[model samples]
Target: MRIPRIYSAGDLAENTSAELDAAASNHVGKVLRMKPGQSLILFNGSGVDYTATITCVTKKHVIASIESATEIPSESPLATHIGQVMSRGDRMDYMIQKSTELGATEITPLTSERCEVKLKGDREEKRVKQWQQIAISAAEQCGRSKVPLIHPITSVDDWVDNKPEDSLGLVLHHRTTQQLTGIDKPQRVCLLIGPEGGLSEAEIESAINKQFIATTFGPRVFRTETAPVAALSVLQWLWGDFNR
Candidate 1:
């Protein structure tokens, strides 16, 4: 059987016994019903995976003894940072999950004039934490040792101001004339995908002025959640490990 992969925030070292967090414990003990003595892979997002043996499994928690650690070589050489407009409900969740699987190094939830989701204060913190967990789960499922960093929610204008002017930035606008094919090779790329209502004209102009190229994905228009996946897939094929 394929060994189960679990993520924990605790420090992991060979022969050290670590208690799984409540969420992970519930998964191993209740969901998977894994018993003591079964082997599983544990990752702490430190770019290494630990071979662990279940020492105890109880209703409240699961404890495992780390056997050994191996560095994972799955990270992409071409890093991509996604500045996605805040989407509604589970759409944002889905975006975070798939983006992590596609090897996004960083993800920032961008709020624009067209954003329908209003988040602030404690609620926003909780949401960001939830999204970060989704990213962690995606990393585990996709065999990625390092979980992508989930940045806090910010305004699109602020995001543009922070990014360098010379970097290869792109805004996925349907009316754009440029395609991804002829662009010069960049070590890193930052992409912005608007919400369901799309970016306002002023927002698009602002991004364009800040060195964000207006790029399109052929003729058909993709949904906000689906756009990132399509863009990332093609990017991977062209510049990331998908070539292997």
Candidate 2:
């Protein structure tokens, strides 16, 4: 059987015991019903995987003995940060999960003029936490040692203004005929995907003014949630780990 990989928030060191966090503990003890001596993999988003053996299991806690640490170089060479306008319902959840699996270094929930989702105060905090968990789960399943950072929701204008200076920025829109073929390879990339109703002409122009190249995958337009998956896949194949 395949050994389960669990994400633990605490520090993990070789030959040391690690107390799995409450969520991980519940997964191992209550959900999986794993017993002592069962082997598992633990990661703390440190780019290292800890080989561990279950040592204790209680109703609310699961402790594991770290056997060894192995560096897992699963990150893509081309760092991709996705700024996605929040979609309604499970669409946003699906985007976060797929973006994590696709080697997104960071994801920011963007609020665009056409965005249908409105989250504020406690609801916003709760949603960010939930989206982060989704990224963690995707990392666990996809053998990624590092979980992508999920930023709190921000407006499109604010997100564009705050992009890393060194990163190449690309905004996806159907109106643009620009493609990724002629663009020079970049060490880091920031991709902005608009909402279901799409970004306004002024919003797209604003991003373009901020040095964001308006680009498209093809003549066809993808849904807000699906664009990240397609764009990231092509990016990985062209400039990331896919060729390696």
Candidate 3:
């Protein structure tokens, strides 16, 4: 059987044993129904996954012992950061989850001129945490050793202006004549995408003024959540590890 892989924050070392955290312990015990002697994989976003076997199980805790460590090098050489305008409900969750699986190095939630959802204080924190969990789960399942960074939410203009100098940046819009394949490869890229209502013409212009090139996906219009996944897939296939 394929051993299930899980993300854990505990230190993993040869001959070391640690109790699983409450969340992971509950999962291993209740959800997976794992027991002593069964093997599983664990990663802590520390660049390697531990091959571990269950050593103990109880209602209070679940413990695993590391048998070996394996290096997982699935990351792409070219770093890609996506600045996505936040959408409503599960739509934003879906976008974040799939993008994490597709090897986006960083994600920044943006409040744009056309954005519909408004978040402040604790509610915003909660949403970010939820999205972060989705990203963590995606990394585990997709066999990625490094978890993508979910940046704090910020305004669209601020995000664009503060982007790293050497990074190539692109904004998706219907008006742009440029295509993804036409651009030269850079060490890093920041992809800016709009929300459900899409970017206002002025917002698109602001991105352009900040040196972000406008690009189009195709003739058809895509929902905010769907566009990022499709675009990232194409990008990875063309310039990342997906073609392998």
Candidate 4:
């Protein structure tokens, strides 16, 4: 059987014991009903996977003895930072999950003029935490050692203006005919994806002014949740690990 992979927030080292966090503990002890001596893989976003054996299982805790450490070289060369306008319902959740699987290094929940979802204060904090968990779960299932960072919510303008220097920026919109061709390879890419109703003309212009090239996949426009997966796949094939 395939060994289960679990993410641990705490430090992990070979020949040491690690106490699974509450969520992981519940998964191992209560859900999986794993017994002592069963093996599992543990990753802590450190780019290393720890081969561990369950040592203890209790109602409140599950402890594992880390047997060995293996460095996983699964990170893509292209660092993709996705700024996605928040969508209603499970769309945002699906975006985060698929983006994580597609090797997005960072993801920011953006608020655009057409965005329908509104989050504030404690509710916003709760949502961010929930989205982070989704990223973590995606990383675990996709065999990624590093989980993508789910940044706090920010406005479209702020996200556009704050991109890292020298990183290529692309704003996806159906109105543009620009494609990703003949462009010099970039070490990083910051992609801005608009909302269901699309970004306002002013918002698009502002992104262009900030040096984001307006680009599109094709004639067909993808939904807010699907664009990241489609765009990231093409990006990976062109400039990331897929080519290698």
lDDT string, candidate 3, 1-244, tens digits: 8888888877877778867877778889999999999998888888898898999999979999888899988898778999999998799889988998889999999999889989999998988888888898899888998888888899999999988989888898876668977677788889999999999999889989999989988888889999889888878877887877
lDDT of each model, Cα atoms only? 0.92, 0.94, 0.88, 0.95
Runs with alpha carbons beyond 4 Å of true place in candidate 4: none
* Pairs in clash, predicted candidate 1: none
Local accuracy of candidate 1 as per-residue lDDT tens digits, 88-142: 8799899999999999999999999989999989999999999999998999899
Off by over 4 Å in 3: none
Please provide TM-scores, in order, for all candidate models, with all chains considered together. 0.95, 0.99, 0.95, 0.98
Pairs that collide in candidate 3 are none
Ranking by lDDT: 4, 2, 1, 3
Q: Model 2 misses residue 210 by how many Å?
A: 0.2
- Candidate 1 global lDDT: 0.92
Model 4 per-residue lDDT tens digits across residues 1-244: 9899999899899999999998889888998899999999999999999999999999999999999999999999999999999999999999999999999999999998999999999999999999999999999999999999999999999999899888999999898889999999999999999999999999999999999999999999899899999999999999999889
Q: Give me the overall lDDT of model 4.
A: 0.95
**Which whole-number lDDT from 0 to 100 does residue 119 have in model 2?**
92
On the 0 to 100 scale, the lDDT of residue 45 in model 4 is 98
Give candidate 4's root-mean-square deviation (CA, Å): 0.8
